[model samples]
Target: MAYVITKLCLNCKDIACTQVCPVDCIYEYKGDDPSIPKEMLLIDPDECIDCNACVPECPWEAIFEESEVPDIFKDDIELNARIVGKERFVPKRNPDDPIPTPEQIAANKEKWGYKP
Candidate 1:
C-alpha cells in the first residue's frame, strides 16, 4: 500500500518529506488560488512507490503507511485520494528549496486554528 499524509500536516506543510520521495508523488493542494497558503500536502497513492523515504523527513511526523494510519486520522486516506482525483494536486517544491520558517508555520497554524 501507499503512504498517507494525515491532518498533522495541515498547517505545518513541511516539505522535507517531499524532497526525499524518489517518485515525486508528494503534492500540496493549492486550492483555487496559488497565492493562498495550502491547507496540507498529500501523497498520490497511484504514483507512490512505497519507498517510505518520506516517513522520517516530516518534522511534524504526519506521514504514515496507508494501513497504519491512526484511527483519528484515517479519513485522510480518502481526503488525499479525493483531492488527487479533483486534480488539485501539484508537484512539491524543489528539493533544494527551503522549508517554511518557524514564523510562517506559526502564522499558518493560527490561520488554520491548528491545535497541534
Candidate 2:
C-alpha cells in the first residue's frame, strides 16, 4: 500500500519527508494563487514505491502506510488519490531546496493567517 500524508502537515509543511522520498511522489496543492496558504501535501499513490524512507524523515509524523493509517486519518488516503487523480497536485520543491526553519514556518503562518 502507498503512504498518505495527513492533516498534521497542514501548517507544518516540512519538506523533510519529501526530500527523503526515493520517488518524487509527494505533492502540494497551493491552488492557482501564489499568495494563498499552501494546503497539505499528498503522496501520489500511483507513483509511490511504498518505501518507508519518508516516514522517519517527517518531523510532524504526518506520513503513514496505507494499511497502518489511523482511523482518524483514513480520509487522507482517499484525499491523496483524489488530488493526484485530478491532476491538482503540484510536485514538491526540489530535494536540494532548503527546508524552512521553525522561525520561517511561524512567519509564514502569520503571513498567511494560518492558525496552525
Candidate 3:
C-alpha cells in the first residue's frame, strides 16, 4: 500500500522527504482551503513505490502506510491521490527550503490538534 501524508505536515514543508524519495513521488501542495492551512507535501499515491523511503525523513511524523493512517487523517488518503493529478500540485523542490527546528515541529503538530 502507499504511504499517506496527514495534516501533521501542514506548514511543515521540510523537504527532507523529497530529498530521499528514490522515486521522486512526493509533490509540493498548493491548495489554499481553510482546512488545508499552510503549505505541505503530498505523496503521489500512483507513483509511490511503497518503499517507505519517506517515512523516516519526515520530521512531522505525518507519513503512514495506507492502512495505518490515523483516523483523523483518513481523508488524506483520498486527498493524496486526488491532488497528484490536479493543477495545484507539482513535484518541484526549492533550493532554499526551510529546515524546521524541533520547537517549530512541536508547534506545528500542536497547531493541527496533536498534543505532541
Candidate 4:
C-alpha cells in the first residue's frame, strides 16, 4: 500500500515532503499556488515506491501509510490515483505547479472544509 496526503495539508501547502521524496512521488501544484502550499500537495501513488521517505519529512504531519490513514481521509488514496492516473503514477503536473482554477480550489476546499 502507498501513503496518502490528507486534508490536514490544506492551506498549509508545505512542500517539505516533496523535497524529501526520493522517487519524486510527492508533487505540489505550482501554477496558481506558488510555493506549493499544503492545499496543493498531492502524492502520486503511481510514482511512489512506498519508500516512506515522505512520511517523516512532512512538517504538517499530513502523510500517512494507507492502512494507518483515518477513514475520513482514506478516500484520498483513490483521489490521488485517479487524479495522477491509476496506472501511471508520475505526477501529471509538477508538485510546485498550481492549477488554481475555481473548480480545482473548490474541489479541494470541499474536502478541506469538512476536516474530519
Candidate 5:
C-alpha cells in the first residue's frame, strides 16, 4: 500500500520526503484557501511505489502507511486520491532543504493543532 501524507504537514512542507522519493510521486497542491499556512504536499498513492522511502524523511511525522494512517487523518486517504484529477497541483518537490529538528517538528505539529 502507498504511504499517506497527513494533516501534520499542513504548515510544514519540508520536501525531505520528496528529495529521496525514487519515483517522485509527491505533489504540491495549489489551493487558494487562506487558512493554509503553507503549500500542501501530497503523495500520489497510485504512483507511489510503496518503497517506504518517504516515510522517514518527513520530519513532521506526516507520512504514514495507508493502512496505518491514524483515524484523525483518515479522511486524507480519500482526499489524496480525489484531489489528483480534480485540483490544481504540481510536482514541486526538489530542493536539498534542511530537515527540521525534533523541537521544530513538534512545534509545527502543534501549530496545526496536533500533539504527540
Candidate 6:
C-alpha cells in the first residue's frame, strides 16, 4: 500500500518528510497555495514506489499506510490520492524548500483556516 498524509499535517507543514524522500515522490508547491487550501504535504502514489521512505521521515507522524491507518483516517487515503492527482486541496510549496517559519505557519493558518 502507498503512504497517505493525514490531518495531523494540516498546520504542522514540516518539511522533514521531504528531506528523507529518496524518490522525490513527496512534494509541495513552495509558498504558493495555488489551491487556496492548507499548506499540507502530499505523497504521489503514482510516483511513490512504496519504499516506505517517507513514513518514518515525518516528525509529526502524519504519513501512514492505507491499512495501518485508523478508521477515522481512512478518508485521507482518497484525499492523498486526490491531492496528488488533481492538486485539489494542495497548497503550492516546493519539495526542496524549507519548512514554514512559526510566523509563516500562523499566516498560513489565516490563509487556509484549518480546524484545530
TM-score of 2: 0.68
For residues 1-116, write the lDDT of model 5, one tens digit per residue: 78888888875776777778898778775666543223557777888889998887777789889999887788878767644544444454546666778888878767766655
Per-residue lDDT tens digits of candidate 4, residues 1-112?
A: 7788887677756466766777777665544423233354677777778889888766556788888887777777765554363222223324674435545545654665
Q: Spell out the clash pairs found in candidate 6.
A: 28-93, 29-92, 29-93, 29-94, 30-92, 30-93, 30-94
Best by the lDDT measure? 3
Cα RMSD, model 6 = 6.8
TM-score of each: 0.70, 0.68, 0.76, 0.62, 0.75, 0.64
The CA-based lDDT of model 1 is what?
A: 0.73
Q: Which residue pairs show collisions in model 1?
A: none
In order of TM-score, best first, we have 3, 5, 1, 2, 6, 4
- Tell me the tens digit of each residue's lDDT in model 6 across 6-48: 7667767766777676777766634344543346777777877
After superposing candidate 5, which stretches have Cα over 4 Å from the reference?
30-38, 86-98, 111-116
Q: List residue ranges in candidate 6 displaced over 4 A.
A: 29-36, 85-116
- Please give, for residues 51-101, the per-residue lDDT of candidate 1 as tens digits: 888997876667889998877777888877755554455555555656666
Better of 1 and 4 by TM-score: 1
Higher-ranked by lDDT: 4 or 6? 6
RMSD of each: 5.0, 6.1, 3.1, 8.9, 3.3, 6.8
- When 1 and 3 are scored with TM-score, the better candidate is 3
**Tens digit of lDDT per residue, candidate 3, span 36-102?**
4237777888889999988988877889999988777888898777656654544445668776788
Candidate lDDT values, in order: 0.73, 0.70, 0.75, 0.63, 0.73, 0.64
